[model samples]
Target: MSTNRRTFLTGLAAAGGFAIASPAVLGQAKPRVVVIGGGAGGATAARYIAKDSAGAISVALIEENEVYQTCFHSNLFIGGFKSYEEISHRYDALAKNHGITLARARATQIDRDKKEVVLSTGARLPYDRLVVSPGIDLKYDSVPGWSKDVEEAMPHGWKPGRQTQLIKQKLDAVPNGGTILMIAPPNPYRCPPGPYERASMFAHVLKASGKRDCKIFILDPKDSFSKQGVFQEGWEKHYGAMIEWLGPKVHDGIKSVDPKTNTVVTGFETYKDCAFVNVIPAQMAGEIARSAGLAPAGGYCTIDPASMKSVVDPNIFVLGDACIGGDMPKSAFSANSQAKVAAMVIRGELAGARTFPARYINTCWSLIETDDTVKVGGRYEAKDGKIAAAETFVSQPRESAELRKENQAENVGWYAAITADMFS
Candidate 1:
């Protein structure tokens, strides 16, 4: 370790459990970084900044949850291909190994002018830089007659955690020959291919459970979806006639939902007697971001494509599903990529580290069946004041079986690597 790192470690050891020490007490200024949220983007950002800075910067991570269950690969858990425990990750390593102060409290407000974060416990944390990556919040009312109270009957399962378990329970309890109704969200939502991947998972569980007569209906607001050809081909090959996708032209629009009777009233027709329902409503940046006035008309935080700094507040950096990443779809991988760019910029500004041009990459992998996977991704860079796609690829229909298996294996490997990068 360098002399600067040794001095940093000594300061941390002297400060005890306190991640940030007063300038008067330390006899020098210690730049502090406060990060909110512990998901893909937030966790990765916190770890990289704290680790690469080598304790030169005081880092505090605020997250309400002790253990985080990833929204990524959650469909595999629901499909019985992976266990819930396998997808769940603990944050102890981040604190113990990376020297991040774990503030197990919700951040109630962001005082951007003051450069401080107010916690639910009424404590205030002052920071030189703040990273806000609280992810997406579902707009329950976006779909008429739907809210949190009625979510039990028609769980979105979009946020992971309890909703994920509930959806799996509902899926297992679904009777043979039952029909499942899924209302897919519009464009610019987290994980563009998530709902369709979930549909495939539901089909897998039903088929594996010998409920061959069970069927699913996907009502999408958009005319087309991510990897439409690949997903359609995979569904036809594996699910046969089990799944049906209806676009806006067919469903007209979702008028209302009666969760009590498991009914969905669309502009075209009324769907009643649905055995299970998953309604992924429109989304916005999390409450903290909205309350801070960081988001604009699009309901997402807009940032400088080169640095990931919020347009509204230079001291605040936004990441993941909450930020409007130009050509990059809102996915965990995209968020992780953005986090690194933001971290590099912050370090360059605060720690005098060398800065480089921002380059980003993202790949979204969706499993359609056992050993059948499809993907869409691209390389991105800061160009013309926006994150522009440089190169892109997508899985095509009628690929070789070996190639499909390889894609599935690659997905599994990525999950392992990314979770380690975030929490371990």
Candidate 2:
């Protein structure tokens, strides 16, 4: 084995040994794992543990929302191609079929010393192991002059459900030949390609509505974004003169917006009377993670790649957008991939078996236009206590009609499979 690989395996073995020994010293009962945030990662972990443990280990899930509206296909709703109901799912299947106790409550805090999760209702759920996938929480303050109360004026729509509908409503209410301003957040946010895809979908709506004069302006914090070249090409071909992008150097791309005045300030220039403003701000792990003392100073939870366990509190493991996994962008696909790895590690540790070196894979697909799509995929491996991309499977700038059609179809299929895997 390579030097780095050898070192990683050795460290994992040592950590596993320490975990096993510590239980004996601590005098804990049979292992019971509790998972928080029953979205992609938490749901997957709960189902896998419940099925794989064979009743030897207990598994429980906690979530605030009874229904989950996936963010993956939410852009379709914005584009008027699909309804919100199409992307929403319930937890009935998880509770009835999976044999996992679904606690419909928000986690208030995690007592690391006692290994217990405190709920918002003041109920405490004890666990031998805790898995958190609370996902991303919007940093509204990241953009000056914007607060939660001002959300009605400028919707971030980062989270799924009502916020998405509100943004779509705002778009639909805009006058014909109006301008839509989309502000993309900085790096290390949920779904790197989401903002661009959203802009494309909005443009599609504008074209279909016969608003030929309507334009979508993207104010981006980064110089370049995912599938930039392909998205630009699609915009030029499909919505010529209707789409414009300004990067950081372009006056830092709208430093602030005064909702009442209907003005967006970028350096010395001001854009007034924009119909809709979709401001995607910076993101961090959900408040639950921060309350649980799981997040690091940088506002994300640090975890050991081998087991996805929080370094400070070994009993707790965090995944999805909340985790700081090297080279893994926070996306539903990446969360699903990491969930499987986390499940295997939890299973092995609880079963007193050796934790195997594992690999994770993530593939993110973005629709530039109705028939044009772009994708990027990669594999990650644990190295020296952190995860690193081992390989990539990316789509080219331009694709054949057949390939584009295949991707579009596959995107739907993937969504179905993943959501089913989570709730069903």
Candidate 3:
């Protein structure tokens, strides 16, 4: 973020007088704010509430994992540009410095009637306001003949952590001239450019390792993807004929996938044998969100655009990949941006703190090759009862190498800055 943007957000945080509807949460003795998932959205919301309220609000963050492996730049790590520890963030700082309670246990249920979150250990946490940001969950049955049990053989690496490491290890173990297949997810998934960037990283590894004979196949369910022209241009320029993308017109549909034999079956062709297969199935909001009836039939929670409050319940807010982020792609930066708005709004409702109109910004920078990156971003605001795009930009093809290098620098810088914004 630039100094101008930082100053603008700080000003918004400091000075505002608007008030929204609230439950009977006002004038409580240190009203509790409970945040779940502790990723970009949860952590930022928790920190901002504790900091801005100056201990007037008690914040509790519930995350099952002590260390969070960010999914934002895991592709870069797989491509050898980053170390594992570099993307991992710890919650010790959040607890010690922010005076927030950290709960390290799986949240099993959201008892809206009782106004409590039931943990896996059978403990209940009462809250005046709840922020559910559990991120995404893969629909195991979305892919034919694939299930959670098959993840060991065919890993998605979508949510990061061990799956990320497993995919990296598998990539390293592939023999020279071997073929790798990736089953791309459908639209409305997290990280719009992730799969293609990962494919570029795979090619980068092969080209660097003198394994140019290896081939990569991306069977995408969509006709086109984000930054299609630029990605295709870069692949043709750098990877030569090493990568091939088969769209729905060509693949027709996925018949089945046999993880036991490392095979993928498509309508046009059946890959009877493959060295490695990475399948990213369809996704939905996390288990707790769907189970709590907050998410509608579409498998994502609906939220008021201005405050990010759940449409069904004013006291509950949903953030990150779990909420229907109209006109916004589900990126870590977007989640972090939404978190701040939710924090400000929650404070306005609970502590009678000042509030301002919500504005969100997101920029997704994708690394294609060495010092070669591309990006797509925008600024958004609430309009017509929905969060709509106000301004947008994307990388263009035939750009100078120097400009691409500059974009890569931006990618690195933004990653460092946003990690601190979320976890520090």
Counted clashes in each candidate structure: 0, 0, 0
Model 3, range 1-424, lDDT digits (tens) per residue?
Answer: 9855764575455444233334445646789999998989999999999999999999999999989999989999999999999989999987888899999999999999989999998999999889999999999999998999999799999998999998899898778889899999997899999999999999999899999889999999999999989999999999999999999999998999998888999999988668789999988999999898888767788999888999988779999899999999999999999999999988887888877678899999999899999999999988788889999999999999999999999999998888887777
For candidate 1, which ten residues in a row score worst on lDDT?
A: 17-26
* Regions more than 4 Å wrong, model 1: 1-28
Model 1 lDDT per residue over 1-424, tens place: 9854664465345334322333332333778899999999999999999999998888899999988999999999999989999999999988889899999999999998888999999999999889999999999889999998988889999998999999999999999999999999998899999999999999999999899999899999999999999999999999899999999999899999998989999999998899998999999999999999999766899899978999998889999999989999999999999999888877766676666667799999999999998989999987777889999999998999999999999999999999999998
TM-score of every model versus the real structure? 0.93, 0.94, 0.95
Record all residue pairs in model 3 with backbone atoms less than 3 Å apart, i.e. clashing. none
Note the residue pairs that clash in candidate 1: none
Q: How much is 120 displaced in model 1, in angstroms? A: 0.6
TM-score of 3: 0.95
Q: What TM-score should be assigned to candidate 2?
A: 0.94
TM-score of 1: 0.93
lDDT of each: 0.90, 0.84, 0.90
Taking the tens digit of each residue's C-alpha lDDT, what string does model 2 give over 369-389?
786777887999887678889
Q: What is the alpha-carbon lDDT of model 2 when measured against the actual structure?
A: 0.84
